[model samples]
Target chain A: MPHDHDHPHSLLPPDPALRVKALETILTEKGLVDPAALDEIIDTYQNRIGPRNGARVVARMWCDPGFREEMLKDPMPRLREMGLYGRQGEHMVFVENTRDVHNVVVCTLCSCYPWPLLGIPPGWYKSDAYRARVVREPRKVLAEFGVDLPGETRVRVWDSTAEIRYLVVPQRPEGTDGMDEPDLAALVTRDSMVGTGLVPGPTP
Target chain B: MSRVHDMGGRFGDGTVAPGEDAVFAAPWHGRALALTLAAGALGHWTIDASRHARESLSPRDYARFSYYEKWLAALADMLVARGIVTEDELQAGHAAEQSSLSERALMAGSVAGVLKSGSVYDRAGPAPALVVGARVRTRRPARNTMVEGGHTRLPGYAAGATGTVVRLHGTHVFPDSNAHGLGEAPEPLYAVAFEARELWGAAAEGDEVIVDLWQSYLEPA
Candidate 1:
């Protein structure tokens, strides 16, 4: 490994190849990982099946009331029922969004979210600011995300600890009242079901 | 070492930076890439390794692993864009670890030992404090910002906020690192209800907003 201490003068630094190589060497020496094996694992997970599976399951739950109820009571049964059980969502709760009230879920401890339903939680949910602020000042926190609810709507913040994982079942919006299940399904955004946003119907 | 997952709720309220959630808006592949890099950096390779491997870890360990998995997945995208590491390299490393990484990976990932001796809430039994409808006041710390420090009972959003204990949900193991390991004894935790005005300003108007706060975060009004 050649050291780069002897050179410099130009404003632009060289590429980070050396640093990457060094890191790779260190990881290999420590026996922390095998580079070849790692590549295959990453390729399969990243390119193959992804959050789409979880998103579809959530979409299905949004349209099926009975399934949604089962998901709320014990998410695992319904999740397994739907073959969507795994990852961080072994235990789950589906919070229903209703008129006059909205449910926003946060893992105040460390982002214990329902990955099986909504997929991985957004980074903001795990940050110190979100975990801390959302539980206390939810309206304000929601406001920052462009999710401003009138003060009249009560914000119920669920702190997901270890035993339970939660998902927000957003209220079905008005314009989609007469729409069929599949059309209504398109209206369910992961955020809305997470209680951070509403499922707005298709543009008039 | 204190696993970040084991130290939940340690930071006092208000420390979470604004607009942090959108960072996870990337596509699933990007998120997976982020997770792999994080697992490598933290020396915890089993989180997303596979279903069987994950099941082998204890509940506490599983909790920490899950936390890291979410963190890494989100972080990988940022790392790739910043050129800290390449997508190919990150992926390759993850795959290598999958087949050959040993039990050390599991031990290296353990944060169970770092958990505090007693949890603020009892994960094992029942919460030991004010029940729903019990009158309680927010515990006013000497400094409001202290609430912003690492895991505390008080929620940053609820500091200076007051309410009646609305529900006495059964004892939940308090997530605070300082409180995680408390043995068998029950600790008081409460689900308090606060008026929207109390959390926001007077201009706010809504039915009372209910939050599940621990007993440590409250005081007698």
Candidate 2:
């Protein structure tokens, strides 16, 4: 098996952490980049924006049919209005998962994911194993992710090779009719929007 | 031609470890990502160009480097190639001289707005050639092909396969052209749906795979 990190015997820098620091130092000295800017960008993704943004969007869809229909028909404008439009998410598509269908997203060519809503993609999403195997054996891949659908449910794997980004609207769990938007959002997991994990049912 | 990054279905890739879901595995990973993005804001190269650099790595290097490592390597190469940085400066870990490009720094305050109002590739172009429900076949991969070493959005598994166009994405930037210093040359894009069997034979058990393919990659079947 190929090791994910650089080989210990390789000529490349033995310590990647130091290499990154050196790169930053040189770039900073040249005035080509600002350390403050890097921090801001990292902080934005790490703290400000994340799966919670997507969870709220998904929760709204579950509570309001009109919003869901509008979103499914034309999502970019709606997403923009909600401050969820940005880099890696300029063009968006929401693939709804229903009783008969299940949807998942992947970018085999590279790791292209929706950043504004979901933040950076998880580590596994960019793994060669997932990119290579998911397209061929999606059922098996989903099962490994602990998502097992009924045999009758059709699986649609969306390969995001172009500018279009996809988000899967997982089926709302049963017996959550009384939950409010925030409550519903709390139930939505990052994996559900990515179609790897289902939203759990309301607690007993 | 198939590249190392185009691994969609050629077996023996092993199992996916989804539990390793941290956005940044180490301190350096986040810095690598931030540095790459910050450098990218210089307008020195297009996103397609950067992607091409990453995909152009030797197979051995590509396999050994982790995801963020690839980004850093490609970013360094692009910086030197674009004359933004030099090998000496990189090696010495210091700047040799003041860069004239200082005016183009992406400031901390502007980061939010710039990221929010991202680059737009959608451009005015001719009408789409194929419509929804149109049957199409992707161009078959040849041993030596179009713009050899050029980047492509087409994955190896989908090449030469037949599928139905389920949706039209309108004309957008074609990566094949854009990645090679060619113009955007926007083309109609479509969501082509193929049964798992069509792509991987009866041994493949998935229900379907819908790929967003440019019109240039397809022809009426």
Q: Give the Å shift of residue A151 in candidate 1.
A: 6.2
Candidate 2: tens digits of C-alpha lDDT, residues B64-183: 888988887788777777888877676667789878888888899999998899777777897888988999999888222358868888888998999999988878998888887888
Worst 10 residues of 1 chain B by lDDT: B111-120
TM-score per candidate: 0.57, 0.95
* lDDT (10s digit) by residue, model 1, range A159-178: 65334556677776776656
Interface RMSD, every prediction, one decimal place? 11.5, 3.2
Best by lDDT: 2
When superposed on Cα atoms, how far off is each prediction in RMSD? Answer: 10.8, 3.4
Count of steric clashes across candidates, in order: 44, 0
Clashes counted in candidate 1 amount to 44
* Error in Å for residue B139 of model 2: 0.1
In order, the candidates keep a fraction of the true contacts of 0.18, 0.74
Tens-place lDDT per residue, model 1, B12-52, is: 54544444444234343333343344344443322222221
- Report how far residue A194 has shifted in candidate 1, in Å: 2.7
lDDT of 2 at B48: 90
The C-alpha lDDT values of all candidates are: 0.50, 0.86
Q: Please identify model 2 stretches exceeding 4 Å from their true place.
A: A1-12, B142-146, B203-206
Top candidate (TM-score) = 2
